[model samples]
Target: MADKQLMTYEVGEQMNLMALLKNVTVRVAKNGKQYLDLTFEDQSGEISGKFWDASAADIDRFQAGRVVRLAGKRETYQGSPQVRIAGLRLANADEPHQPGDFVVHAPMKASDMEEQINQVVFEITNQVWNRIVRFLLAKHRKAFFSYPAAKHNHHAFEGGLAFHTLSILRLAHSVVQQYSSIDAPLLYAGAILHDLGKVIELSGPVSTQYTVEGNLLGHISIVDGEIVSACNELKFDLNSENVVLLRHMILAHHGLMEYGSPVRPRLLEAEVLHQLDELDASIMMMTTAVEKTSPGEFGERLFAMDGRSFYRPNEPQAGGPAVK
Candidate 1:
């Protein structure tokens, strides 16, 4: 029989697992001995491990992001699963280890997401807007497809940035159809380029964290700056209406000043972008919370949603009254 995945290991089970050593920290125990506090991850999930009385040599041997073979037993501490490591060593060259096997990513395949995004880009008809969007997309395609939308919160897995962008573009399509007054080209470009700055803002796909720029300028400002630079490089008129409107969409996507938008949305397209962005993020966040909670119970308080816990209903509601 195949071995159980990391998430399936139950408390008290002896596990001989191979996983990526994602993080490591040295701490002094009460007895004055140093110990290694580590995080191990495989595609299924991640677990913490404590190596009691670890020496300096051990720290050097098992660095972060390296694959390691571990013999341990699972235990629960503060309602979370952790492992007590009895033995561990760097995974040897002969081991059947693959980096892709250890990373958590968006549910959709990366290639599929990229194709969908490209299709949306093809839909943009404004020549200058199309050129600028295509140029930026081609430049950042690698990181754009690999990076998570955020370190944590909604769409916080690999390929999340692309997944989130594509999701918003799909929403924009429906919104344009519903309201023919909305400019389809401008809305489509706004949806595609809304979060382009995150590629520079985030560290990378694995162990995602905010970079110094991400903490200071944030994605909104970063992408706004990118828009200016891209236009300058392409020799597109700085004062062109399309250029200014696209920049406005990125800067005001957060919707309000307190939410990190430098300026409140002023244009109809910008306002639509803000609303669509919020709707997508809120749906993903609430859906994720609901899925993680036990049926008939409330999920943990969500800081993003004003510290409210969502209830996981035991059953789906029946269809409501049909529209006459």
Candidate 2:
């Protein structure tokens, strides 16, 4: 008998259906088609599945971000392995762990990402900006260190918000410094502080979910309001235009009303931050999704990322077919 490759099942492995699924989100498909679509992960990474006739009774048992067992044969679509459900149900606490179990992260490593943020902070020479940055970084360390950038968008892994935000700001600063026409401190500060409110907007990894505060007051307002309060405390010697400009960058980072920004990027620095932030985040999402996908196959459809499908690159040639 061919040993099943754990996550990659062979023809007739006695796999437990409920043990292999992760982030199992069940919902009604179009035209009343009972369906379930969710990612199944192993140590190798995550892959998604869609079941056409997932039952209503079983639907209640499986929820988003929950693991379940499956007893089914492995099937492929477009060269991707998908589980055709012979049986499925909720995985109990005491159920023996399976080899190909999927574990979802709480965004993506916020603490290490925060250290990257501090690199940008140390570069600022403006004392007032430094104080404001310190206060928020200190006060909201928990949220700042843990929250996902969005509920389902890019950087949705553990500590993903912090990692993405820091990366965007750092990259943006590098580019802006070349011109020297832009104020380095202001632009970098704006970039670093741009997504500070995300801590409150989303929950941490332990919970791996959103909170009431997030639903009501979003990251934009939370961050904008915090910046205003921090400025008041620091007694910043800023003209109204400077304050407004910085605030606009935070408010407009989302870049569109439909997307979430109340105001668009108005100033040069604000425009730069918005564009760079978007560019970094989008690239990260696409690249990470691609990495999780199998080689010689197109990746799963990313709904939050405009339903864009990505193709995994073919593996490099194995040095001319193994010289004997």
Cα lDDT of candidate 1 equals 0.84
lDDT of each: 0.84, 0.69
- Deviation in Å, model 2, residue 136 alpha carbon: 1.3
| Model 1 Cα lDDT, one tens digit per residue, 1-324 | 655667777778999978877668899999999988888877776778898888889878877777888898988664346888888988889884665567778889889998998898788899888988998998898999998898767887788899999999999999998999999998889898899899999987776668999999899888888888889899999898888888888888898999998899999999999999889888888887776454666876778999887887776546854222
Candidate 2 lDDT by residue in tens digits, 121-161: 88777777777888888888876766667665576655666
C-alpha TM-scores of all predictions: 0.81, 0.77
Which residue runs of candidate 2 sit more than 4 Å off their true CA positions?
1-26, 29-37, 40-44, 50-60, 73-81, 92-111, 206-208, 232-242, 292-297, 301-307, 320-324
Worst 10 residues of 1 by lDDT: 315-324
Listed per model in order, the count of residue pairs whose N, CA or C atoms clash below 3 Å is: 0, 18
Best by TM-score: 1
Taking all chains together, the TM-score of candidate 2 against the true structure is: 0.77
